[model samples]
Target: MAESENGATQPQQPQQAPKMNVLAQFVRDLSFENILSQKGAGGDVQPDVQVQVNLDAKKRSVENQYEVVLKLKVDSKSKSNGAQLFLLELDYVGVFNIENVPEDQLHPFLLIECPRMLFPFARRIVSDMSRDGGFPPLNLEMIDFLALYRAEIQRRQAATQAEASNAPTQ
Candidate 1:
């Protein structure tokens, strides 16, 4: 107990723990193309696959709720002759109810944590889509959302600085 001006003892209040819950998750859009089948190319070929990921988050009309979308693009090409093999695009969305998080930290929490929760489902969809599209099952590597967020912040800072430098003096 700390001494006050009147030497009165006071009890300290405990802080509330942060809360997060996924209200729903679904695929907003999906597309797959079997290029090798379309081209009728039949031959043994080594496959080189590339994956890209993007994220978006927005506040919902309801309080303490947000929508996050994870966009993924997968492309496969023949290593031997660089012929297109297949392509897949997916937009997975999740609705989250979050509370007790600080306002300053909510943006990062949504972009990083919410998508992390939804990635396994998205990965499975990609695998199934590739197999169904007449190609081998494609398993995607885990993403580093924290690194991505840091890089995006740096990019935005650089762009803002460049714009400030390029602005004409009045």
Candidate 2:
């Protein structure tokens, strides 16, 4: 309420909070190989596992829709002999309907928030695949998506700077 020349009540518009919904989620591709079984090597050996993650997001044809893909690669090896034990690669896709987010914040939201939403399912798939393949269930640790996003941005900026410096003095 405000007093103009004559006192009158004014209606204030409310700001809408950012909204996001998962329209669909699916596994685009999955591969699991139990190398130890294939090689007939069985013993009480310690496992060394390595994991890599990549993320990509793009706008969809439908209004306010976006598709985000999370790619994961896991490799396990025997700690003693360094022999390969198992390999797992998975590509997960999520379709989201998002609204009311500012343009500058959309990229991070898509990469960080969307993947965070999909990670639990992806992790479960990995655990099941590993267990089904004969070894113990491989429970993946929680990933810090915000840190990953920031590191990627820093890497790109560094690459751009290096390219500019090596531009043959143009």
Candidate 3:
């Protein structure tokens, strides 16, 4: 503690700037399936591709380290024949070191920023996997993680409100 000229102690100052880092990233799990015969898969028919993205975070320590995982699930089916074309599941994990982020802001940072950092690698993997599986490369569109997070929160809030309303009145 430091004392002022009049003997009042000065508040401690933060020792460092806000810091966020991607310590490491890796593919935790990857699965790809090609559902049609290699020769004529989706040749005549247009395939409908659906992609789902999910993000998860786990604190690594009492300090400011965390593990963020981005999961991508994709399915492609031929609309005309009702046949499956391809399916993919990927779990990409990143070890991050984050510090000085406020509690309220931390959740967004973990879900959005961390996953954004990991998306390119994960996307490349998906594209390569699809091409290697004898199909065209699957180019995933950019994800709006913040929107997804907000939407999920809104959904949970709506569910909670519905549950409260449905409860027996006191």
Cα distance off (Å), candidate 2, residue 110: 0.2
Top-scoring candidate (lDDT): 2
Per-residue lDDT, model 3, residue 148, is 91
Taking the tens digit of each residue's C-alpha lDDT, what string does model 1 give over 1-170?
55678989776666688899999999999999889989888767789999999999999999999999999999899998899999899999999999999999999999889999999999999999999988778889999999989999999999999999999999
- Model 2 clash count equals 0
- Model 3 agreement with the true structure over 46-162: per-residue lDDT tens digits: 779999998899998657889999999999888887688888999999999998888898999999889989999999999999899887888899998889999989999999999
lDDT of each: 0.93, 0.96, 0.89
Between prediction 2 and prediction 3, the one with superior TM-score is: 2
Candidate 2 per-residue C-alpha lDDT over 27-133 given as tens digits, one digit per residue, 9 for 90 to 100: 99999999998999898879999999999999999999999999999999999889999999999999999999999999999999999999999999999999999
In candidate 3, where is summed lDDT lowest over 10 consecutive residues?
37-46
Pairs in clash, predicted candidate 3: none
Between 1 and 3, whose lDDT is larger? 1
Q: How many residue pairs clash in each candidate at the backbone level?
A: 0, 0, 0
Name model 3 segments beyond 4 Å from true.
1-17, 38-42
List candidate 1 segments past 4 Å from native. 1-9
